[model samples]
Target: MRATSQDTAGGVRRTRNAAQTREALLQVASRRFARDGYASTTVREIADEAGVNVALISRYFASKEGLFEACLAAAVTDLRRDAGDTSLEAIAPSIARRMVGATSDGGRLPDTLLLLLRSSGDEHVDNVRREFLQSLSERMAAASPAGPETLLRAQILLATTLGMALLRTSMSIQPLAAATEQDLLGPVSDLVDALLAEKR
Candidate 1:
C-alpha cells in the first residue's frame, strides 16, 4: 500500500496531541502536588484537571509515580538545562534569590521543593528525589571546572541552596526570611564566591 497525505497528517496530529496531553498533565500535576503534597494528589484529579482520561496519563507515563517524576522534571526545566552563560560564581546571587523565591507568594512553597520534601514519605518517591538530586548535582558540577574542590563546591552549593530554602521557606526564620532582596543577594554572592576562592 502507498502512503497517503491524510495518513501522514493524522500521524503528525497524533504526535502533537500526545505532546499537548503530556504537557497538560504535567502542568496540572505540578500545581496539585505543590498545593496538596505528593501523597495527597490523586491521579484522577490530575486527569480531570488536564481534561484527559486517567488512562492517557498512564499511557504517557507508566504510573502515578512516573507522572510525578515528569512533573518534577518539568518544574525545574530552567535549572535542569542551564542557568546562564556565566561562571558558576556569577550565578550565586541569582541562586540566592531563587532560594528566597521558593515561597514566591509568601504562602505556598515552590513545586520543586515541595516535591522533594514530600518524596520522603514513600519509598518510590524517595528514589525519585534521590535520583533527581543526583542528576541535578552532576549537571551543576559539569558546568564548573573538574576537580575535587569544584566537585566539593557543587555538593556544598546544593546543600546550601536546599538549606536556604528550608530555612527561609519551611522554617521561615526571622531576619533572613524577612530580609530584602538587596540584603540577601549581596551576602549570598559573597558566600558563593568565598567557596570559589583558591584553597588556602
Candidate 2:
C-alpha cells in the first residue's frame, strides 16, 4: 500500500521532535557537566532536568561518556563557528568582546569555556581537553609569523584568554569582573600586537 500524506506529515513531526529532544539533552548535559563535572553528574539528573526519558540518554548518546564527549564536541564546534577567519590582528579584540559579552549574560562562563576549564577527574576526558587547547594554540600560531617561538606565543595568548575568562566569569575578581569591553580592548589588543608582531 502507498503511504498517505497524513502519514508522511506524522513522520516529519516525529523526526523534528527527535532532533529537538537530542538538542535538549545536549544543552542540559553540557550545563550539568560544566557545573558538576562528568563523574559527578548522573544520566537520570540530566533526563529529569530535560524532561525526557532516562533511557533516551542511551538512545541518543550510547552512555554517559558518550554524552560528555558529545557535549565537548558541540562546544568546540560553537567556538570554531564564532572564531571563523578572524585575522591575527583582530583575534584579541574579538575574544575580548566575547569575554565581556559573556559577563552580561548572567555573569557566567560560556558553556564551551567552562567545559575546558572544569576537570572531569577522568584521564581520558582531561586528555581531550588538553588536545583541544593544543590544537587551538597551533591554529593561532599559524596566523602569525613563523618562528621557533610563535607557537609558544600563541599558547601564551590562549592562556591569557582562558585566564581572563576564568577571572571575569568564574572567579568574579574585583575590577576585572566589573570591566567593560572598552576597558579591555586596548590592553588586549596591545598584548596581541606585542606577542604576534613580526620582528623588525
Candidate 3:
C-alpha cells in the first residue's frame, strides 16, 4: 500500500521529534551529571530538568547508574578513536594527547570524572574499576601474545592510562595538568616498554 504525502510527513515529524527529545535528554543528563555528580544526581531530577517525565528517563536510560555508565563509555570510546595506534613506544604519547584533548573539549568529563574519583572509595566504584580493567585485559589478550610479557605489558598500559586519566580528570593537580603531553607520555611509554620486555 502506498502512503499519502501527509502520512509520510507525519512519520518524519514523529522521528524528528523523538530524536530531538533524546538529544535534549542526553544534553540535560550530561550537564546534570557533570554539575551534580552521578551519585548526587537523581533520575527524577534529571527528568524534571529536561521537562520530561520520570518514566521517560527510565525508558531511555533504564537507571541512573546505567546512564552514567553509558556516558563514560561514550567518552572513553571517543578518546580511543582519537588515540589511534602509535606503536607501543608512541602509544602513550598519542594517548596523552587524546586524553588532554578529550578533557579540554569543554564537555561533561571534568565535572563527572571528578565525581567518580571522589567516589572511588565506594563499592560500586571498585566494581566499575574492576570491570574496566577486565575489559582492557580481554582486549589486550585478544590482540597480544598469550604470555607473561604480554600480560605485564597489558597491566602497565592500563595502569598508565588510568593514572593519567585520574590525574588529568580527577586530581586536577596544576603541575600534572600543566605537563606537556609528551612529558607525561615519555615516562609512561618507557614503563610500558619495560613491562613488555619482561618474560614469563
Top-lDDT candidate index? 2
Task: Sort the candidates on TM-score, descending order.
Answer: 2, 1, 3
| lDDT agreement of model 3 with the native | 0.56
lDDT of each: 0.64, 0.76, 0.56
How does each model score on TM-score?
Answer: 0.60, 0.76, 0.58
**What TM-score should be assigned to candidate 2?**
0.76
TM-score of model 3 vs. true structure: 0.58
Question: Model 2, range 11-125, lDDT digits (tens) per residue?
Answer: 4422226677788898888878876667788999999998767878997899988888888777776676666665787787777777766422232345567778766566786
By lDDT, is 1 or 3 better? 1
- Per-residue lDDT of 1-200 in model 3, one digit per residue for the tens? 22222223234322225455555676677656655566677887877786655666666677776666655555445444544453454555655565555443345334433333333234664566466556654555344443645766676676666666567655577777667766767676676555553344
Candidate 1 runs further than 4 Å off: 1-18, 34-36, 48-56, 75-77, 100-109, 113-132, 135-150, 167-181
Candidate 2: lDDT over CA atoms?
0.76
- The TM-score obtained by model 1 is 0.60
What does the lDDT read for residue 67 in candidate 3?
67
Ten residues in a row with the worst lDDT in model 1?
Answer: 1-10
